[model samples]
Target: MALFEIDESSGLPVWVQLRNRFVYLIKTGHYQPGDQLPSVRTLAAEAAINYNTVSKVYVNLESDGYVESVRGRGVFVRDIGGKADDVRSIADTEIEGCIRRCLALGMTIDEVTLRMMDVAHRLKDEKS
Candidate 1:
């Protein structure tokens, strides 16, 4: 099984960190279709967190259609269909959250757009 690192001091909750890590693993092909995930107990032990926390992350991922659990077997990664609608929905939600945060910080739309473009360009360059 692959190892995951968790930061105890991060602003994000532990469950969110685990969920995001799992998503990143799936997206990066570190975990493939039918790959068995570590049990909640095992993952919790490894992460030094409560098992319930890991369970919550797995439950959310399963509900989101990213994984499936079999009665007698461990959880497995599902085949992501690359559904554009689902992708767009997730992206829209994330963008909305970012916009809200920027607005709360008193940033104007133009300033936000400029900063977003700058980050986008940097990401594009990094990818290249």
Candidate 2:
């Protein structure tokens, strides 16, 4: 059975959604390294998405070193860093990159801190 269904209502691209889903599956130990993924055609038919979309997602994942494709075999997850805190590591790396870019643009530490706090506050308000 398919493990996840994409959220059609989300503004994110289908490929991005697929990529996130597979990543989460791996991180959560739902898909271990060497576990074969459903064939692209099968998955596309199941997801009711275009074949090209799923193919692109798989291709991108393979290129990102997240998955491997073997001739006459199938796509399988790769052992990427093997850290339980992989998500946090990724988030920290991306956030650090953003902070560096902001700093390069002459943004101040206090400005960035205040803006982040405001964003968090807005999120908290939304949950209320």
What TM-score would each prediction reach against the true structure? 0.62, 0.64
Off by over 4 Å in 2: 88-128
Model 2: pairs clashing at backbone N, Cα or C within 3 Å: none
lDDT (CA) per prediction: 0.84, 0.84
Please report the TM-score between candidate 2 and the true structure: 0.64
Q: State residue 95's C-alpha deviation in candidate 2, in Å.
A: 16
Highest TM-score: give the candidate number.
Answer: 2
lDDT score of residue 32 within candidate 1: 86
Off by over 4 Å in 1: 83-128
Q: Candidate 1 local accuracy as lDDT? A: 0.84
lDDT of 2 by residue, 1-128 (tens): 34757776689998899989888777767788889999999999988988999999999989988889998899998887665478768888998897888788898988877877888899656544
